[model samples]
Target: MTMRAVRLVPALIILLVALTCASLMIGSVSLSWIDLIKGFIRQDQTAALIIYDIRLPRTLLALSVGFVLGLSGAALQGLLRNPLADPALFGAPQAAALGAVLVLYTGTVEALSFALPVAALGGALLSVLLVLAVAGRVAGVTTLILAGLAVASLAAALTSIVINLSANPFAVTEIVFWLLGSFEDRSFRHVAMAAPFMVIGSLLLLRAGEPLRALTLGEETAESLGLSLVRERILIVLGVACALGGAVSVSGAIGFVGLVAPHLVRDAVKGDPKAVLLPAALVGAALTLSADMLARLVPAPTELKVGALTALMGVPFFLAIIARRRGAIAADAS
Candidate 1:
């Protein structure tokens, strides 16, 4: 690693820690540093109750979900050699959301804690399988993207149908808000359910970095280096399915973090997708935590949706990247 890269990692880690503390303290109650210490140290029961029961899970959820999204995004981009690639682009989040909604629609969301995430995981796995099946073992990146788009569209359509057919207005409302994404009112159960899968997925994606570096030389070159394209593709797809599925199952459909996070750190890492993964994850966590804090702290009748806030922050970045790429293309053509 270069000197700048070595320095960047520590800086990002510090930023994440600061943001995490801020997330825990910036809720409706507005805890101070002493209050935070007292709460964790058990010197204050009320503060402890508030921190542990309400904020801890929410903070952890944001951190884990953001980390997974960023890492998966970086990994997917490496796999496809497309900077715009995101786990959500493959319909994993949409499919997972649909699965959770199915549980909600069937009135089983309340019955069991594990049911929602499990169903969502199942949906995500199915989407990955469908994409792989349609794209075929030897299909190119473009084909994989097209297959993913089809699955995403179908998942979205099915979710809409469920909403339309629901008899309970309240249930429909819950589902709608969930689709918008937030860490509000989440609990330790959610943390438990999602964290393990995210960790597993992250491990899988981290392994792709070396192979992805080889892939930068082109598929045939990578093959000459003895990197199995087929196996690599499967690793990334399954990793995304697990990580993104777990994230969406709990937080709903938070977007843009994956797409934006890698870009934030890409330059610092000298455009190495492998190097981008960890820093992107840290940036993603910081972004999500910051957004979640704003959602709570912003003066409103109700808390803003974190998903909406992220989109507001991310959309302009997305457009700017596209315009820059367009300019580059035009220049190349010229």
Candidate 2:
């Protein structure tokens, strides 16, 4: 690593630590640093309840979810050779959300807390399989992207239909909440529920890192370097789906962090794919944690959706990237 990159590591670590403490301390009811420290040590009951019950789990969930999304986005972007590619671009999140909605709208989720995550996993896996199947043999990046778009459109249409057909007001409200995304009232149980899948997914993506780096020069070049394109593609797709599915299942469709975080880190790190992953994950954690903090604090007692905040920030940034890319292409053409 360059000296500049090495310098960034310490800065990133400090930033992450600061963000974690801020997340723990700045909530609807503020807690002083001493109280926060005391809560962890069981020195104060009020501090204990607030820290243990509310802030800790929420912070952990945000970290875990952000890590998964950032890693997933980095992997997918690397695999597809498209900076704009996201886990959702492949229909994973939409399909997973649909699965959770199906269970909730049918009133089956209440009976089984694990049902929604399981259903979401199934939906995500199915979407990946469908995209691969449609792409068929000798599938190139363009074909895969087209196939993903088709699957995403289909999953979205199906989700809309389910929401529209649901009769229960409660179910509709629940579905809407899930779509908007929030970390409010999420407990350790939710953390425990999603951890395994996210961990597995992270491992899979990390394992593929070298192969993905080889792929940067193109499939033929990667193949010349003895990288199995097929296996790598499958691994990346499954890894992203597993990680992102668990996240969407738990937090409900928190968008843009996946797309934005990786890009920011890639630029900061000068496009070193391996170096980009962890920094992107840290940035993702920081972004989501800050957004969740804002979601709770904004509008006083009322909370804004975490996903809405991300989208609000992400859309303009996304547009700017698109515009710049277009301008670059035009210049090149000229």
Candidate 3:
């Protein structure tokens, strides 16, 4: 690693820690550092109840899901060689949300234990498989992107329709909340459900970096280096599906962190996707935790949807990137 990159890692880690603490402190019932310490160390019941039971899960959820989104984003970008690629682009989160909604709207969400996450995983896996099946039939990056985009649109439409058809007022409200995505009222159960799947998926995706670099030399060269294209593709697709699915199952449909996180650390990683994963994850954690904090602290009686804020920030950033790319294309054409 370059000196600059090494320096960047520590700074990002510190920032993540700071953001996490800030998040823990800013809830409806504010928590002091001493109280947090007393809660954990001295087992003060009320302080412990508020700090450990309430805030910790949300903080952890934000951190882990952020890492997963960023890691999956960097990994997917490496796989597709497209910086714009993200979990949302592939329909994983939308599909997962759809799955959760189906279970909820049908009145089975609570009846079947583990139904919410299982259905979500199934939906995400199905979407990934569909995208892969379609893209595999073609022979280019453009086809892959188009396939993912189509699936995402379809899944999102289906999710909206499901919400629309829900007769129960409470079910409709729940579905709407999931679509907007937040970490509010989250618990340790959510953390437990999401963390393991995310870790497994992250392990699989992190392995892609070296092979992805080899792939930059072309399929023939990468193959000659013993990189199996089929295996690489499967790992990344499955990895992203699992990580993103787990995240959405717990947090609803938080977006843009994946698309934006990698770019935040691209300079530190010197555009090497392999080196980008860890830093992107760290920055993503910091960024997401900060966003969640802002969502709660925004002075509105009701908290802002974390998803909405992310889109507000991310959409403009995405547009700016597109504009820059357009300018570059025009410059090249001239």
Candidate 4:
């Protein structure tokens, strides 16, 4: 690793810590530095309760979710060799949303606390499988993307139908909020629920990192290096589905963290794929935690949906990426 890549670690760690503190400190009900300090020491009941029972879990959830999204996004981009590729782009989030909507509207999830996430995971896996079936071969990124688009469209249509036909007045609202995304009212239970899946997904992706790096040289060349393109693609898709689907199931479709985090880290690390993973995860955690903080504070008591905030910030970045890609293509053609 170069010195520049080495420098990113400390900087990212510092940034993550600062953002985490900012997340804990600033909220609707402001707490002083003393209160914050005392809360950790158990010297202040209200402070401890707010910090431990509410903010801490939310922060942890944001961190975990962000880590998963970032890693998944990086893995997807690496696997497909497309900067635009992400879990959301490939129908994972849409399918997960559809699953959650089904359970929420049918009132099945109300009885089973974990049903929503399980269904969402299943939907994500199903979408990936469908996309793979349609693509026929994992070597074709173009075909895979198109397949994902088709699956996403289908999932969206189904979700809309479910929302429209629901008789329960609250069902629509719940679905909308889940789609919009937020960390509000999230507890340790949610943290516990999502942690294992996210961890496993991260490990799976991490293990595939070396092969993904080899894929940069083209699939045939990578295959010549003894890497199984099919196995790598399947692992990547499954890892993304598990991590991103579980995240959306719990936090809704928090957009742009996956897209933005990995790109930012790649820039920071000078485009070394292997070196970018952990930094991407840290940047993702910081982005989500900071965004969650602003989502809570920006609209006062109204509380902007975290997804909306991320979208608001992310969309412009996405457009810029599109513009850059277009410019590059034009340059190449010229």
Best by lDDT: 1
lDDT of each: 0.83, 0.80, 0.81, 0.80
Instruction: For candidate 4, write residues 1-334 as lDDT tens digits.
Output: 6787789879888888888777888887888889989997889999999999999899999988988888887887787666776676667788988987888778666723677777888888888777767766443545655777899999989998999999988877878877888999888888877777788788888888788889888788999999988888788878887787678778988877888989987876677666777777788888888889888887665678988988898989988986777765455344
Give per-model TM-scores.
0.91, 0.90, 0.91, 0.92
Segments of candidate 2 deviating more than 4 angstroms: 128-150, 327-334
Lowest lDDT block of 10, candidate 2: 325-334
Model 1: which residue pairs collide? none
lDDT of 4 at 276: 74
**What lDDT is reached at residue 316 by model 4?**
95
In the order shown, the candidates' Cα RMSDs to the true structure are 2.8, 2.9, 2.7, 2.5
C-alpha-based local distance difference test score of model 1? 0.83
**Of the pair 1 and 4, which is ahead by lDDT?**
1
Q: What is the lDDT of residue 126 in candidate 3?
A: 87
Clashes of each: 0, 0, 0, 0
Q: lDDT per residue, candidate 1, 95-160, as tens digits?
A: 989998898787766723667777787788788778768876444545766788999999999999
The local lDDT score (0 to 100) that residue 28 gets in candidate 3 is 82
